[model samples]
Target: MWTASAVLPGAGPADWRELRRDGEAAEFHAATEMLELHGAETEAYLHGLTAEIPSLYVIMRETAGECPLEIVQITASPYEAQDYTDSGEEIVEKVPMPHGLVAWVRDFVEEFHQDEIFVKRKRDKKRIDIVEDGVGDPRIDKAADIYASPSLKRRRLQ
Candidate 1:
């Protein structure tokens, strides 16, 4: 079965702990707050945490076959689990995030995360012209010239 856990940083080993699934939601209680997450929202919350916090991570575990358990680290964008998997065997289960953790992640993301805007570069209109003009071979140049000349338009006679 797929299970989710919270890895809290501290001096003690108990800092890393498993979250309990209650009904449709997973819950985690800290000294200050309680986190609960449900359904697909859990995954998004964990992903946000992994992206915003350096020490926080979402782990996908597979408990079968020779490996028994294989752990994969979830990242924000560039290092997604799908990018590393070469075959179906490498696929693992996704776990949900706890409720309190979601709130923490939301706060972290709000404060630290900056969305990157992608700007599409305009294609050069003269690129083909440059390639045709730069060709040194006489045969290729002749063909290009023939293909490009507007006066060579084919006319149909009835």
Candidate 2:
């Protein structure tokens, strides 16, 4: 089983302390403690966490109005903090995965991920006669002109 949590920067220590003091505050707040996942559900959630789009925009309702900001996503099973920004900003803070978690992820990837084999398409053998005898060659003159009929006009009028 894996767990996920969303930590917003705007919700500072003071807000967290208040949330701790009043358990009911958690219901109203965007910050969730931990959400458990299982089986294929875990894999699906993990895929979302590992997606290329790192940061997600979330609407925060304040007394004045609603504000939106990009927030980092964190996962527990594989234990990764994906801090991605759309503005091409470099992420300074690093969240290292534990050795056990790394091994587990590796095993999961090995079991599920399969590399697609590249098979080069075989080229059709060139007809030596076609290359040797040009289009207007006398040898191919006996061949029927399929495009000779006016009824077979290729153009279409809109």
Candidate 3:
């Protein structure tokens, strides 16, 4: 289990730092990741930040190259994380957000988040009961009774 212990503020250049090693299990820390916020994604970020735990989602992807696993993304938006999880190869983990980062995200959301107004679309009240031309029951020929099937039409003709 790869757990994010902490995010160093303004740390220069991030790389995997080995934390501890057990018999077979080992822990590596990837630091100095910058979480970018978008104006369009503020709604998603707000939804995630308001959660009881207010956690960040870490997305790890399997690489075909020399590195077996790679840190693809770290997102505050659960929606973004969910998108990555749709691909079975990616591993998504929810890590608890730092208090300072939570506050920072709150400020960003407050500044960018705008309430979208809901407008109910008015449906057309036009009568659809009247059958249009060439839209009647196709089983009956135009020369036969509208209610009659092809068999009935043949019998009537006979």
TM-scores for every predicted model: 0.39, 0.28, 0.73
* Prediction 2 global C-alpha lDDT: 0.37
Q: What clash count goes with each model?
A: 5, 0, 0
Give all candidates' CA lDDT scores: 0.44, 0.37, 0.78
Candidate 3 has which clashing residue pairs, if any? Answer: none
Model 2, which residues run further than 4 Å from truth? 1-70, 75-93, 121-158
Pairing residues by index, what is the TM-score of model 2? 0.28
Q: Estimate the overall C-alpha local distance difference test score of candidate 1.
A: 0.44
Q: 1-158, model 1: which lDDT tens digit per residue?
A: 43434444222323223347678765542212222333334344445566544323343446556433444554332234444454655543333444554566667556555555889999877656445454444434465565453454468998
Model 2 lDDT per residue over 1-158, tens place: 11112344334332223233254333223343222333443444355447553322222222323422222333433322232323344232323434454455545655665555889999789776656332343433334643343333368789
State the TM-score for model 3: 0.73
lDDT of candidate 3 at residue 139, scale 0 to 100: 72
Per-candidate Cα RMSD to the true structure, in Å, reads 13.4, 12.0, 6.6
What's the CA error at residue 108 for candidate 3, in Å?
Answer: 0.4
Q: Which structure among the candidates has the greatest lDDT? A: 3
Please give me the total number of clashing residue pairs in predicted model 1: 5
Find the 10 residues in a row with the least total lDDT in model 3: 149-158
